[model samples]
Target: MVMGIQQVSLSADGHRAAVVSLRDGVPSIYLIKNPFERRLVSDTLAPTVWAQRRLRQVPRLAPALALASEALRQRNPFLRDASYTTPPAGPLLAASEPAGSNGTNGHGEAPDSTRYGTLRVDFRNYVFSSAFDEARPPRATPSYYSSDPFAPKDNVDENGRYRPRRYRLYFTPDLVYGAAGYDMLYGVQSVTQMMFSDMLGNHRIWAATNLLVDLRNSDYLIAYSYLPRRTDWTVAVYHVARLLPDYALRTLYRYRHYGLNLSASYPLNKFERFDFGLAYMGVNQTDIGNLARPPVTRTLFYPSITYTRDVSVPGLLAPIGGHRLALQLSGSPGNLLYGRQIRFVTLLADARTYTSFGRGLYSFAFRLAGGASFGPNPQLFYSAGVENWINRRFDSFPIEDLTDFVFATPVLPLRATDINTLKGPYFGLFNAEFRFPLVAALLPGPLPILPLYNLQGTAFLDAGAVWGSPSNRRLNLFRRDEHGRQVLDDLRVAGGLGLRTIILGFPFRFDFAWPFDGRRFLHRRFYFSVGLDF
Candidate 1:
């Protein structure tokens, strides 16, 4: 297994022969005429390379000349003559033609004769790395040469067969330090994350933490994943906590919890996958004001399954085309693992489609999402507000009793309203947004002070509804009627304009909306959130 000639094949015409050689154990092909025989008329050997080399690439003289002319005119006051002040040429493919009607080139007086332009080389290794990086412990290392580098090579192995992938060491793929926070909820938080994986990404390890200003509120997480075969397995553990202040009741609350989780993800194909998870967590909610009182405590065991299909084309600011769908079934069942009183079953579906206007990134996005709960202890759901919103504000209908429901479901982004504006057992939502970029191709990249990217504008509409059994008088969808009974309202709708940008590697979003029903025209709602627009 040397980096030298391995095999050879000859054409029927005895004038030429095809050579199979190895470079660092990888194979390549070369052709030579009259093998094993050489005849040179001159006594001295020729130069190995007589001219500059290029690999299927060429340069033109027009742009360089145009640039030189413009530079000369701009810096010299004597160049005010119309004959010397022509603008530079526009961007175009490379050509040898002269710029701006200059019929003659710098060497116009030279005699018209042909000579070698360059040494056009087809070094296949430059096209791509050696397909074979590993070979059965080679005896020794040897060099190789090729004339027809484009010719394909054969991997007969002296005895015909194939090779397999070999194991590789881990390398760092993600390492970052960034800021994280929402206005009133999490004030000026910071997060750091690191991840390492093998060359093929078949194995990985991740460690992340959010250690805030107050050490008591620190959160830590670590995980390991193995995906060498058909199934991907992940094991994770976390110790996370949060502290909240309430000025109204003159109380400070702390939600201290820890959890361990295991999951397996199996790819059905390239665009679809199945994920199954089992997790356990212990919750502790304490009111600091009354230390003598026992904190609200609960233990839960969760088992879930999800199916997702994503076939989206990535764009600068967002997906330009295709769609994604995710359907999930999850439950916290009593006695399934540990907690005896915990019981709930939840089903959710989320679908999104992004369609661009031809090749231009005039992205039009639409999303539909819904969820439902079953069993006596069904999970609570919330509606309204963006994710990780800052400078938070609430409308006249202030949300109440959100502490118990906040952990039950993720915030459904319903701009024009505050976080947890509505809560219920079931809810559905629809969203549509038209996004266009301002100099998207010319990116707004990172600066020394702040990292920023992907600036785009959006026009959007959001509509959603949340409701449950009329008997549940505590639900936000239930309002007192003339007869003092609970009644449900029609769909809540909002239309708005928005902007999207990424700062500190986070998708920072801003939205302003008005009540689409026209009843609240004067009331304009503004939201600043940290997340991509759905």
Candidate 2:
């Protein structure tokens, strides 16, 4: 009586349940009521029920237990308490057991914990923060890798297959031969050029000679030029013997000049530059097949200054956009600076504008140029045909027979008229052109064998006039035609179509032009030449 349970225990056989009670302050041991039945049921069903519950929780508990074990092993403070609440799960159990178990092999002793707790990490520091800085390991500049159309590629190896030589020489031949009406016309022209660096004490030197022979005339031009490294100055000496064609008078005039020239250029900015030059020349002239005029000889000193501003996008053959303006003043005096023969002052101004359309697929360009000469001497300015490095086309039959040909001059093209037919002391010219891509735009495929892929097409109109000096009455070439109209009233005008292409690093052009100023289309002219700017 008056019994209370103090402790409960199970027998070693697990088949009996026992309870210890304090009955009247005296400890007493007693078997639990129906101990055998309870033990039998517990032993048979308890293990299976516990196993089913644990299997259900294994998936959810595995990650948490693994994380806690990892944290304890790594000495992480956040999960240490949770990891200690239960023996570490799975394989980590042995390593995370009680310190006594970890310390010894059935013996009390401390083991090495330092080896398990240490952590090592490797870090890197940045060497550069911006792309513009030179790459520390040595690399090419940004411009060398740029694909911008306007970027310069002076040092870029475009093909990566060939390297250029330090010095080179080039030669070009421009020859023409034809026969018309019992006249066997023939011309042989050639230009031989040699260029080398450091030829004369760290200066670049270029030596060239041009030789031309025709049925009625022959000429030779020799020039030697020098340019110092990293400078804009040029020194040259040249000798030239040329034949001037007179279409009006149907005669050839011999002109000769040998000169030494020194010139320098200064760039004001990216778009503007100034040029100055001085020259001393010995000149001679002889009128051939005509006795009306005597041969004239003179020594001339020429000094010139020019200012140019170009804000144009350069193309393979010409400018595609923007404008350019040039102003020049040149004086040739007989008794000024070291001369005693001819005296005159000349002023010239030229301007050009280019407009693009259709996303640069086409362009319209216009140019205006004028020049005036003053003094008592008969300074000649011819207006008739275009400018060219080599005149491959034949001149009018009578004026320039198989034996005679025209030389290059300051004369600008009038397109519609004959060469050297209009001459005076003052002249002006205007030219307009519409240019578009030809083969490049149409085909646009790589053709290693065909160099004509760079062809460009153009339609152009040219008009110009020359007039006599206002002060000289006798030298006035502007007179009335048979219709009592001023000759100046009938300005020379012409229109034509042309094709341009590049060959051997130079631009070559072929033009078929017809004069519209009272001339039949049958008299149209064909010209083949080399030049970029019209």
Cα-based lDDT for every prediction: 0.66, 0.60
lDDT of 1 by residue, 1-534 (tens): 334677889888777898899866778888889875766776653211111011111232222233346666344322212222232222111123233233222223111211123322332234554646555454432222133343324423566664333454757776566545554354566568888887778788988888766645678889999988999999999877777666677888777767899999999999999999998877667888889977776677889999999999888767889999999999877644543476778899999999998585698999999998887676776654777777675432222332242345644567645645665668888889899975443433564455345578999888887666446533353356577754445356788898888765667888888865323343788887777666
Worst lDDT run of 10 residues, candidate 1, spans: 48-57
Q: Scored by Cα lDDT, where does model 1 land?
A: 0.66
- Which residue pairs overlap in candidate 1's backbone? none
What is the RMSD of candidate 2? Answer: 31.1
**Cα lDDT over the full model 2:** 0.60
Q: Write the per-residue lDDT of candidate 2 for residues 20-60, one digit (tens) a residue.
A: 88876889888765565654423332222223233432222
Off by over 4 Å in 1: 1-184, 198-201, 212-216, 335-340, 394-406, 438-455, 469-490, 502-506, 517-522
